[model samples]
Target: MTTFPQHSRNFLFTVLALVLPVLLGAATILAKTLTVSPTGKIRSVKEAVRLAQPYDTIWVNAGIYHENEITIDKPLAIIGRQQAVLDARFKKGIFSVMAENVLIAGLTLQNVEESFTKNYAAVRVRGGGHVTVRNNTILNSYYGVYLEQTDSCTVSHNLIRGNAKQESTSGNAIHLWRTDHINIVSNKVSGHRDGIYLETSSNSTITGNISQNNLRYGLHFMFSDNNSYQRNQFMRNGSGIAVMYSRNIIMTDNLFEENWGAAAYGILLKDITDGYIERNIFRQNTTGIYAEGSSRLLLKNNEFRNNGWAVRLLGSSEDLTFEQNNFIGNTFEISTSTNYSSHNTFRANYWSSYTGYDLDKDGTGDVPHKPVKLFSYLLEDIPTSVVLLRSLFIDLLELMEKVAPVLTPENVLDNEPSTRLNVWKS
Candidate 1:
């Protein structure tokens, strides 16, 4: 070990303290602001970028500028005064950022080009870190804000609306590829192929977003891990959200509602492990949650209501626990295949259809509530038989099977079913 003398260390600290402020002041002095307006000398944003230096601010005044394929290669803040518009004219991408510490805010970008072999974005940040795209409106873009191979970036408070009609041509609203530690917050996305799509990203936060009326999943992520999604609304899309091939996910306090289609689900979890899902509302979807090859997941304090099937638990899932959730007004509470082994547990949940009494005043039913109905299991094999759902003969058969516990999976039951609604607390 080498040690400095006391006077030597003190002198070194004194030198650093004297020089650091001058360097910081020099950086601040070098960062200049350039203004652009329709009537000004610098009328075009591309020309403003060409005139500006690194760490400069390009302030675009409120006007319409027809520009496309504007490449930004230096660190800069491209801010708009009011809601300045960038019209791409359906030619190419609006802003392509390849620099660090870049900020693009308070701008409306529209008419990004649609390409068969490329993804044209309103604001594309590629291979950069500490970038932010905030308070912007993206209209009719192929991809609203695309982040690729970036870290520590944020996309927040942006409204991205696309006029997408089909999945073959439309791109995602917010697309992330090979990024990490990104924050996607408070954005509204609609009419895109996917509202928010992530691929091979990790350690990110997605919260307070509205994703609806899209052609595909509202939020879709694959091979991303250690991510958290909270307080987001996913409604009336082709499907709600798809989380696949990930591990250690935290999904809580989200609303999944009215995503109605034959193949739609509130959430599709496939090949995932070690996840925590709590306090989410899954309502009026074709299926609330469909889990396949998922394991070691804790689903607690969730509400499933008025869906065709609340949960479709496949045979490959194991070690899952559904605790303190509410299942109400669903056509089928749970549906499972015949080959499904009872490797999951359901405990202390409330069921609206539960008729058992709590004789000892324990607030739990004396008899167990079987959530997986025989008819639902039959529908797994014969989906066409759902037309006979409300008939008297089907009702009698369901009644008989409930009393006998036949054909339904024996272990799939809420042993301590709550007698009342809203019994669980956060």
Candidate 2:
């Protein structure tokens, strides 16, 4: 062979050195996937986990694995193929992931035993970043998924249901405690104590969830701040949703429907501040939005339809504004203990009960529309007085109150009521 130049030999050696590690790294990334099946070499998932390198995939086939508890301490992707079952033997959680960047996907975890203590979940992320628990089916479990003290995790595309009857014994379906920046999206939860419970968690986004038919509030958040829930549905729960002692919350494009009970409401805003409730539909609720000691809320473009008391402002609430909303077919549009002071302002809403005329050819009415009738306040004190709602005497009393307001709040006025209906295409 002809002798090569010094620079050419140096360049070849450099290229070989750079390309060697790349080939090894590619082989590591494309590492062997361990098959966990009855007939496979690795029969148990726990043994596969012990033998697997970090970032390797453990493909579990369709079979039942009696795993009372599983701890994923390494960054492994444990994916189930075709509904592989992880029966927890009526014990505690099925999987407790304690590693960073772990993924558990497409599994069926079921039959967790009920416990008075130790909230048992199907899957729990204790402390990790970039942990994703997705596309799993959890049935008859105590707690569906729990994220405690975890950060930047995702819990998405999971179907969770529990037949929990007692509140003192059952736990939440998806419970987040002290977890921050968690993205809980596109999950369906039902028949649990609370569908989703957030306590002292912050900077989280819960979007596109359908929570219904739970024993308690469909979604409850307490002492959680800077969180946003959008495009979610909360229907037919014990007390629909309770947001307590939270600040800087945004609730948009949500459906709160058919939450009818003695204490049920579409949403209970208690002691919250600096929040925005926009473009939401509150229909067929006992009370659409009950405000208690809440302040500085911007409620806009929302529709309250056929509710008992559309908005009940408690005596301690202040500085709440209702604007650009449609309040239609509500039994009591606004009810307050004492309307002597204008703690809340109402402006630019379309009320079907408004009898004002637009004489100036403008879209808005010339006179302000008062939503609170005398009957509204009457039903507040005596809820059983609705039997005489359609009688002529009740009509006469409402007409007289509309002509000259005495008992209703004079300050809670929609200054520019729309003469036409504010029909939204939501």
Candidate 3:
């Protein structure tokens, strides 16, 4: 055994303690690879993904790649220089990422298959976190982007659209399941079953998106809690949006327009509780706001115009406040159920149907306006009464009901109404 001197041993230990972390970091950096084109060696995208190490970047050229099921198992960034197309030819998903910290950007994904059993998406992220999907164009897929069992993902600035005629096997544009902390921002989504859907998700923020022409709700949320949706547009869908079976939600500054069906509503709240719905616009829908079995909701500063009904309450709601809203050009301002009296209050709202004269001119209506129309009560009992909507006999009956309170609920009235329209005009 050879023994070192005391001074030599001390110097060796000091050098090792100073240089060990730097050497380990250098090794980690060397493990990452950077791929570039014009090298004439990397031929295909599949070859690049296979040759990529962890934390690698595969820079693709501007061309069409006819491929399907491009599985990404390593944490790599796949970027395109120009307009790179990944055409799936209606076969399967284009990109399937199962690794964390992956980035997919500046690519056009198209022609994903429509499957009856599986959700064939253009990009499917499974069990991945910290993934960023940005600046992509996804077209004609069953689903544009599908996330399952993922967390802390960011989907931003993507254009996703599906063919509306293919309704036999339609999916959502951005479908999320059992995920959390998802940030969906500035995406244009249209022509699917639902534009954006969140199921069993929590703590997600969906903002600055445009969703239109969907067969179902534009933004559908179910069993998701503690989510916030703001500054989105929902237009020309069967139903504008629906938030169901959720609690502690916040919806602000969303636009709902032209969702005109017999049962269509600008926004539907079913079995939801403890939420804030503020500063939304509902225009030209069959119904502006529909609530059933909901409680403890605060609605403020919303605008309702050209809808069949401004608000509909189905007798199961309680502890709701409708304040500082504008109800204009609607056939009916509100409709209430005949079975039970609701515990909701409508205060300080501008109703175009208010007929009471304010003699004192204090910027408030002197007498209350009973918003529940007589025909709405008849529709509740006999659903066929909608056929006589514009008939003269129904108008006469409505006049008679106004003279004498007949079928409408006594407490369903809006008092202290605003004199001017509450138009945000933003």
Candidate 4:
């Protein structure tokens, strides 16, 4: 046995302590790249994932790989070259990710059959953080990209399409449950039950997504709070967008169009409090907005055009402020429930139906605008009376009621109505 002096041993230990971290960092920086190809030694992605270390790169080449339920338990980047397709073969899910900082990009995952007892997704991040699933195409899956108990994850720039006939058999295109700080950006989701469904999720941002032609809602939020939804398009869905049981939300710069059904609206706000619905365009819907049991919501700079009812305020909703909105060519500019004695305030909104003049040359009309028509108030109890719309007797009844101030909710008047349409650049 060779023994060194005490000073020499201490110097060697100090040198090793300095060199070891650099060597380990170099090893981490030089993470190995595993290849998955048709004729390669590592042909399967599951094999690649099994043989990969943390922060390794798995490059899948172009081919149709028949694989399912591929679990990734380590942080890895799975990148596809050319058009790599992972066919689930109508079996289980494609990728079940359980690791943080995982990236799955530029791949096609398809054919995850519907299951009654399970939710199979094309890419599912369970109990993970900072996972990203981007630039992929998900087709015919039960769920496109599912985040369960995930935080700080992103599902962006993906095209998720499903052939959903009924709501019972179909799932959402992008579903988030109990997630926080999620970024769902620039994705196009259609033909699913709901395009994007958030339940019990909070502090998330959903922007620049086009959610159209879904079976149920374009975007559905249930019990989700403190989220931001901006610059999205919700068009031609069965029920449009439904934000329910949530608080402190911000919805701005969205386009809601052509959601025509007897029960459909541009948005249905139920039990929501302390939110902002600003700079949105609601066009050609059955109703632009239907608020029930919502409070303290600021509806500002929104345009409601050519709708059956531009705004339907139920009696249960209170303290909603509608300001600087443009209500143009709607059959009924506003509707309220029978007992509509709420503290809803409407100010500075431009109503095309308003005939009041501004004699003082100010932008605001001198006469206040009463948006709720008598026929609209009557149709709240007798919905079948909508067939009598545009009739002479109904017009006369509305004019008389406007002069006398009868059944329409008096509190839902715009004292400072805008003389011209408000142009918002949001």
The estimated TM-scores of all candidates read 0.97, 0.91, 0.90, 0.94
In angstroms, give how far residue 96 of model 1 lies from its true place: 0.7
**Of the candidates numbered 1 and 2, which has the greater TM-score value?**
1
Q: Write the per-residue lDDT of candidate 3 for residues 311-384, one digit (tens) a residue.
A: 88889998899998999889878887778587898898998878888889888898888888899888877878
Ranking by lDDT: 4, 1, 2, 3
In order, candidate lDDTs are: 0.93, 0.89, 0.88, 0.94
Of candidate 1, the 10-residue stretch with the lowest lDDT total is 417-426
- Number of the top-ranking candidate, with lDDT as the measure: 4
Specify the poorest-scoring 10-residue window by lDDT in model 3: 31-40
List, residue by residue over 174-249, the lDDT tens digit for candidate 4: 9999999999999999999999999999999999999999999999999999999999999999988898999999
Q: Number of the top candidate by TM-score? A: 1
Order the numbered candidates by TM-score, best leading: 1, 4, 2, 3
* RMSD of each candidate relative to the true structure: 1.6, 5.4, 5.0, 4.7
Candidate 4 Cα lDDT to native: 0.94
Q: Which ranges in model 2 have alpha carbons more than 4 Å from their true place?
A: 1-31, 339-342, 423-426
Q: How high is the lDDT of residue 141 in model 3?
A: 85
Candidate 4 error regions (>4 Å):
1-27
